[model samples]
Target: MQKILVAGPTFPDVIERLKQYFEVDWNQGNALSGAELTQRLADKDGALTAGELINAAVLAAAPRLRVVSNMAVGFNNFDMGAFNAVNVLGTNTPDVLNESVADFGWALMMAAARRVVESEHWLRAGEWQKFQYDAFLGADIHGSTLGIVGMGRIGQALARRARGFNMRVVYHNRSRVAPQIEAELNAEYVSKEALLRIADHVVLVLPYTRENHHTIGAAELALMKSGATLTNIARGGIVDDAALAEALRAKRIGAAALDVFEGEPRVHPDLLAVPNVVLTPHIASATEATRRAMANLAADNLMAGLGEGPQAGHPPNPINPDVLGKARRS
Candidate 1:
């Protein structure tokens, strides 16, 4: 039987399913260090990871590795160029977590715009004597111009939710989405600068790429309305966290919320010190059902990518499909 390394903690059911076809080496403790990951993969034929880095060095050490199944929609953890060079397939769980992530994006936006976290902190400190007329005043979500960066599936889902709030949706993407999709969602295409300048609330849903690094930086933040809110549900490093922290401290923009951070698990101290920001530990798709679906899909990818399971030889969400027929193993 082919040996598989299940990196990071995952549902037991996913492990059991994989055990049906492969010898499983499950890591249920804290995240493994780089050396440990490389050592473990030395004897493995494939791996199912949840954000562990699988770069060229790791890939080089794992000569037997043919496939890597990422549990999340964002496979920024995988070094695509190396995977392609070595004919190693990488797959990610996409649509399964779209709605859940969209819902969380809304949560973050609302929390930031309404000063939810800030006010709650104050109230908990026994600072609420009486409700002042202007206490915790915040921007309105209804009748607002909502700007979305990267109008993909999750972005469309956000636009759909905007309808109920009576928000006007404008999005900026690498390329405009289909006209029919825009019409269906009543969304308008705009330039990134235009979106930043005019939007009452800006939500980022773009994937992370070399060109997209720090897509929102000091200059972009300065373009936003002083009272506008910013929310990011996308990958980390897409926004300059330090710049955002400075902006928040200066109140350059009204408020900001982040689900992912640059060099995360280690947020900028400035951001933590600021009171106008709401931060979550990258759990935009943490709903039990959605996470389970993601895990199952990842398992499916690992099985099929290795030429096993019901969908033998056909992984559903291959990141580099060109490497399919040329995989090193199988």
Candidate 2:
């Protein structure tokens, strides 16, 4: 039997299903460190992985390693260049997560802009005095200029949320969306500079890539309107956390919310110091129903990529389809 590995704690049912088809080596903890992870893959022909660092070095170590089906939507943890070089396959669960994450993104934006978390903490501290006239004054989401750093499915979902609020949507992408799309969403295609400069609120939904590291750095942050609100439901490292902390400290932007962070699950200490920022542990797609859907979809990817399901030979989200050649449609 071909050897398969589950590289992290995943749903038990999913593991049992993979066991029916492949020799299963289960790692029941969270992701292993880089060295230990590579060691474990030494015998795995394929893996159902969540957040393990699988790069050229590991691929070189595991000559038998063929497919890696990641349990999450972001595959930035995989070294695509290395996977492509070795003709190894990688896949992620995507569309199944769009709405859940988008909903959370909107929630974070509201929470940050309206001082929801800060005020809650204050109230919890037993400091609920009589309602002050200007206590925790916050920016209004309705009729604000909403800027989106990415215009993918999740980003578009967030734009749709703005519809009831009558917010104008502006976006910056690698390339522009079609005019029809813009018209349909009541959105405008803007340069990154323009998007940063004018919008009252900014949201990030972009993928992480080498080219996109710190896409919103000091310079980008400088362009944002003062007292604006910012939210990130995208991957860590897209925005410079240190710079963001500085901006938050100076009240350069009124507030910020982040569900992802640089080098997480270690959130930046500076972010913790700022009460104006809302922080969450990368749980944008963490609703119970949605999380189960994501897990099942990830299992489906692992099953298909390993040649065991209805999709047996047709894994749906191959990052490098060319790498899988005969393995794909066989």
Cα-based lDDT for every prediction = 0.95, 0.88
Determine which window of 10 residues in candidate 1 has minimal summed lDDT. 321-330
Q: Model 2, 106-190: lDDT tens per residue?
A: 9999999999999999999999989899999999999899999999999999999999999999999999888888888998999
CA deviation > 4 Å runs, candidate 1 = 327-330
User: Which whole-number lDDT from 0 to 100 does residue 11 have in model 1?
Assistant: 91
CA-only RMSD, every prediction = 1.1, 2.1
Error of 2 at 324 (Å): 1.9
Positional deviation of 253 in candidate 2, in angstroms?
0.6
Q: What is the lDDT of residue 316 in candidate 1?
A: 98
lDDT of 1 by residue, 1-330 (tens): 999999989899989999999999999999999999999999998999999999999999999999999998888899998898899999999999999999999999999999999999999999999969999999999999999999999999999999999999999999989999999999999999999999999999999999999999999999999999999999899999999999999999999999999998999999999999999999999999999999999999999999999998999999999999794832
TM per candidate = 0.99, 0.96
Pick the TM-score winner. 1
Model 1 Cα shift for residue 197 (angstroms): 0.7
